[model samples]
Target: MGYVLRVRMASFFAGAATASCIGLSVLYKDYKTPHESISLQAKAFHDSLDTRISTLESLRQSEAPQLPQTTTD
Candidate 1:
């Protein structure tokens, strides 16, 4: 059998954020341009996407109907 790799997107995004913290720290410490503004835009975009994904999940759950369970003797 060949090698197989399985990746979870949530984990990937979380790893990206963790890695970015180190780089962002350095940039923030010495940033003198409009980097903060650009960063804010990027963060806002990410936040919106995360919120939408969560909202969709909640809506899906609420919309799905549950059937009554029948007990068998």
Candidate 2:
């Protein structure tokens, strides 16, 4: 009876260790970030280009001169 109890305990601990390892592997895979990092970099580049185009358009509008008014008395 004592030998049977010891064998049971060993099997229980081994199963627990295997479960813990599987849980850790799943957590590590879920928390990975490579694709998110690349997406953020691309978004930043697009925003910079948009700002540059807006600034150029604003400067052009400001530099253009207005035509003089003609007299029709």
Which stretches of candidate 2 lie above 4 Å from their native place? 33-73
RMSD of 2: 4.9
* C-alpha local distance difference test of each model: 0.85, 0.92
Model 1, 1-72: lDDT tens per residue? Answer: 122223466677889999999889978777745777788899999999999999999999999999899999
Off by over 4 Å in 1: 1-31
Q: Model 2: per-residue lDDT, tens digit, 6-71?
A: 999999999999999999998877666766777899999999999999999999999999889999
| Candidate 2 minimal-lDDT segment of 10 residues | 29-38
**Highest TM-score among the candidates is held by which one?**
2
The estimated TM-scores of all candidates read 0.46, 0.48
Question: Clash pairs of candidate 2?
Answer: none
